[model samples]
Target: MRLLSREIKLCSVLVFLFLFSLKVLAQPPAHDPSKIMRDGDRYWTFKTELGIGAISASNNDFSDWQSEPSVFGDTWPSWINTYVPDFAGHFWAPACIFLNGKYYLYYSCSTMGSHVSAIGLATSPSLNNPDWTDQGMVVYSDGNNTATVSNAIDPAIFKDDDGKAWMTYGSWFGGISIVELDTLTGKTVGEKTTLVGGNHQDIEASFLLKHDDYYYLFVNRGLCCRGVESTYYIQVGRASSVTGPYDGWRTFLQTNGRYIGPGHIGYNEGRLTYHVYDRDDDGTAKMMNTTLDWSDGWPVAVEVTQDPPGELLPDGTYRIQSFDSTKIVGVANNSPYEGANVEILDFSDDNINGTSWVINNVNLHQYQIAPKNYINLGLDVYNCVGDDDANIGLWSYWGGQCQKWIFVDMGNKNYQIRSALSNKPIQVNGTFESGTNIVQMSNNSNDTTQLFTLVLLELEDTTYNQYPQVVSYSSQQSGNPASNIIDGNNSDGYRWSAENFPQYVVIDYGDTLSISGTKIWTYQNRAYQYTVEFDTDIDFSDPYIVDRRTNTSAGQPITDNFEPVAARYARLTVTGAYDYTGPWVSITEFEIIEEEIVGADELTLNDNTKIYPNPVVDVLNIQLPAELSSGADLAIYNMMGQLVFRKTGLKGNIELMNLSNLKKGIYSLIITNNKTFVTKRFVKY
Candidate 1:
């Protein structure tokens, strides 16, 4: 009975292998991951590890995962070492796709920081029981060979709507390039076409996706592999076809708080997969997933704001300096009283406390500026009047329109701080000496007194607001396009006007948002009857309308607040004019305001709880109130809202915690129990 014994042993080995793979792994560290593949009830994805490791998820749960077998195990392709001879046992940026009932996996093989690389291919029938057959190298790069000199790495395969296959591959040496491939053989059939160049030589990791009528190309740029200091971010461009002339390059994702860098994007099954370096956890790369929303025919990552390169002023603590480098904005004589005059003064150590200001983002392209020593008082225009030469003062926060400010980027880190109430830039009153009063004035193209510089003290956690963009409009006059309405400018030269009665503009904020109101600034001070409509779809089918017809007001800016509604696309239709009945309609700026919603789970401030040495180093001491003397739950989260430390069932009022292992960044300490919930911010060095 030898045959029967052998069969029993073989069956037992298969059963053990299946049971071992059932253990779920929490947060499997993956880098340069491929688009997830599916086999029956299991999902599979490959990543760059020891010769390309694979992971799987079962029962339709995409987050819970288990480590699977490596595609080649200890035996890699034999032809890899022949080309460059610096081949190692590791791979980089693997990509996979299914074609003709077979899976084609493409990967990169290269040395560190070099262009002598190659892109290889392998095929398998089933991922659940993989038997990958090496198909040799598809493309390579050489220093001496003129035929294949392009740095070939990060191979991403895409199947067009017409059922033709193509591969997009390259690295820093030649930016990103693409070539057509035969669907049957999974090999290149045409000459490679260079798609786009990188910013310097810091761009790589290209991924291509086809949605609707356009082909979107995603790439990574800036420094990488530097832990918390990595500047890697994602950029996107789109073209009508799969090949040349890809324009409209825009920043898609960026470093937000403890999430240092987000790159290497893959799309599958209505969701996107990428990796972000977690600064709270020693800058480890972790996998992240998000969905997409369309705004004006372009894809925007859901719930993520696009911080435009070189133009965005992130929320933080800064010192406001005028065009004169030695002078800065401060309270007159360092006064702590409300309604104190804000004046420009010379920089000195005694007046450093008055120069520190906290800039908080209130809306899209808007901020609420306040002194760091007194956050309750904010910069405001006196009397709330909308006119030129309005004096600016430090006043208590009353949620007035004059307290809200808009920062207009004038390039080179210089900004024109404009008032939201008057749409006028704040100037130094035509003087540069000490104690010069700051006032609001008319727009001037070449005024240095109006431009101010923001010197950052530290990078802090910032909230996000989805960027609203103008996508479509009914009609526009020459030299004044529809996009000027959302360019964060209210000047007369930057406006959209048309010689028609029924001209309209549509703005897309990417996803469905809780819209509360609209701030419309027209070209002239004329009364106009308009109707605002909103819809979740691009086409205004079954829209929520806010009709403002039969109105009689001639205000420059008409602020209309309505019932909160969920919408994605907002349309403003100018029906008729009341004061001047002419065939002309113009709009200078349009802003959709979001409604703020606070929940009961929010933290409540407690005066009894005191934290010592706010900019603490190594150790942190927390003195809890008498109400929290009993057992409580303590948690510390990074700026990206990621929990880095948690201790449950903590007792006593004075708690001494060691934080020597944490990185140098900002953190929020949260303490909660059955009867108490408190939160505080501290710095770690």
Candidate 2:
């Protein structure tokens, strides 16, 4: 009898396991999941997992959710499967909203390669105990006589800042589209709007959200299936209005480290959540989340710290600077160690791999600083010529003991540095004195010797575009002065009246400059067409056309990048306006820009001194052919000309200027004995 009871218990357990599996399968599918909507404190959403039908779910705490009936409810009485024959049994995308005590669910009923598709809606009173009632078809595209030009899939809704309702939909068949919608009926109104279309229609799965004054459009690009092989990811563009001619698409979520297929996502409160396939976990698509920070008013994903896997520092290249010595460390090009020498020199502005370090965190507060060029070859820090005061250079990054570094945050964005290679902290060895070679020593005296700060290096054009010798311009109308355009002010844009055709402004860059482009700012969306030209003379003799743009609609200040040319004179010609009133042209601010060529910018000399390895790594060897007084002064200045490192009473023939503590980049090195002094350029790797 006991054996019989045991068998019954095992059978019961097996039955429960089967039921649990079914419940998990019944939840909304991962591909193109619906954006969650809030019903008081409870949340509700829909998904395209069920074919030709949409699935529903609700949760009060967001941790646990219970699946509800199909969004079409009781029975899908429509012949949607007939139109979407290829994908007859499945829905593509779904979106939900809670408005006026009614939960409205919208979904795309479509098939592969068939233009005959439709977006339909359903209404429910209570999302938790949903009894969805069909609201009939909202929009459809048959690709027949005068039917919709869009594919009628991937629906997203946007409620404008002013409380107006709009819907965005469509897929590969045509392009992502938008249309105004009635708030009361949840049905589209007004003329169908073609937001984007044609061969550039390599996008789908649209999602929209309004933050601050901008409306952000998120879309999925590339293929969606194949698990680990899926190339799918999310991209975004933003505009000031719900109906938009969005700008270039930027990767909303970048792939590479851990996740993949970050598509068909949603937003809630401050966090953006999306379903992603884990490349390391055999492509099991799961929900992933991230917070955002504003970059010049645009959203950039910020990684949060989680234990175990790789914990990365903020991504970007940097120049490691020592707080004590204030010099940068580098691989010596002048007095190189046997393979790649170690030395210290004044900081430089140029990004040289041997000097520039690519610091990536292995875990929180721990990182591996690799040379930029070496990183490309998969080389990291290794005790290459292994020994005490070993030859440290780039080598393949495996799980080696010497590669790990611990950055001790010493308040105010500074750090007290230590390494996993040795128990001693990294000190600007006085061998330990001023201008001393940096070496890792046993825990000795505590001073500023081991302190360091990572300095950010500008990657943009470093070549300064001369601010023009004279502000020269012309205009036909009154009230607006021609100087306003070249005044370099945006307080109020330049305006004109009693318009002039072929309105033009001439710019004299003071001296000859290699013209590349110009930054034009104007009254919002007024400049429809404009042209830029460069020449050596104002007559435009040997005129070189820089760039011309027609139908310019973007309100943001326009950036026109062109091939660099040598010219001292550039001209701006306004040809037309989109919404022109009478014959008038208004120019706000026009500025000339120059190409930042690698070798064109020479270091300004404050004096003259000889320093070897123009771009030095470790030691900035200074050898004066002449004798110097026992009491001599030497100093290093950064690009900003700020004094960073200095030494007094230096009496020597050759000074081994220890720069291992300075940030990598260009710097002005100065030396003086008696009344004689010299300043010259030096670089730290």
Instruction: Give TM-scores for every candidate, taking all chains together and pairing residue i with residue i.
Output: 0.45, 0.43
Per-residue lDDT over 300-402 for candidate 1, one digit per residue giving the tens place of the 0 to 100 score: 8775432221233556788999986578999888886778999998878887767788876543344667777676578999987656888989975533447
TM-score of 1: 0.45
- Over 404-485, each residue of candidate 2 has an lDDT whose tens digit, in order, gives 5666565666665454434234656554232345566544335676677777663321112222422223233445645466
Q: Candidate 2 regions off by >4 Å?
A: 1-29, 51-61, 72-75, 143-148, 269-271, 289-295, 300-685
What Cα-based lDDT does every candidate model obtain? Answer: 0.70, 0.55
Q: Report RMSD (Å) for each prediction in the order shown.
A: 22.4, 21.0
Instruction: Please give the lDDT score at residue 183 for candidate 2.
Output: 83
| Ten-residue stretch with the least lDDT total in model 2 | 1-10
Query: Which residue pairs collide in model 1, if any?
Result: none
Per-residue error at 670 for model 1, in Å? 46
